[model samples]
Target: AQSVTQPDIHITVSEGASLELRCNYSYGATPYLFWYVQSPGQGLQLLLKYFSGDTLVQGIKGFEAEFKRSQSSFNLRKPSVHWSDAAEYFCAFFTGGGNKLTFGTGTQLKVEL
Candidate 1:
């Protein structure tokens, strides 16, 4: 079965710090990977995606992720976190042979002052 699991339900970080969100997936084939950021009660926005080529991909808001095939993981990272970065992050994979995407539960990022 192809699925995704985000172990962390929520994470807290101080303003101007670093952040990382874990993402693990199980898929039979190498699928299209994506990271989305959603604010409180807001729709999802595409942060970045990894289809082929480089393993490390950069995204908006100074975010990046590295695709690891061995571990079946694609982790999101940010060098310096900001107050505006406080939002929910989700890892999604294109599966079921099409445009449909399966998303993880979600990891709420809270930025403290």
Candidate 2:
């Protein structure tokens, strides 16, 4: 069984500062990596994904992630974060065999102005 772990339960960053959220996974094979962001009272929005090929993948909302197979990590990064970027971020993994997705507890992001 695969699992996702988000070490940081909460993260605070200053607005306009660079941001990086950590995500580590435990899986036998190369599973799919996904980063989803959800605003308060809103549904989850896909930020980025890593399936195959290029290790580095780009996503919407000025987000990008690099799949490191050796490290078993798919960390999300943004050049600069905005106040609007404050939200709960989740890390998920899909084995591709099932429709189920194992997700992390989530990391609440706070952007201080």
Q: Best-fitting candidate, measured by TM-score?
A: 1
In angstroms, the error of model 1 at 52 is: 0.6
Candidate 2's residue-wise lDDT over 40-94, tens digit each?
9999999988889999999998999999989999999999999999999999999
Q: What is the C-alpha RMSD of each candidate to the true structure, in Å?
A: 0.7, 1.0
Q: Estimate each model's TM-score.
A: 0.97, 0.96
The pairs that clash in candidate 2 are none
Q: On a 0 to 1 TM-score scale, where does candidate 1 land against the true structure?
A: 0.97
lDDT (tens digit, per residue) of candidate 1 on 1-113: 88998999989999988988999999999979999999988999999999999999999989999999999999999988999998899999999886699999999999999
* RMSD of model 2 against the true structure: 1.0
How many residue pairs clash per model? Answer: 0, 0
Task: Provide the clash count, candidate 2.
Answer: 0
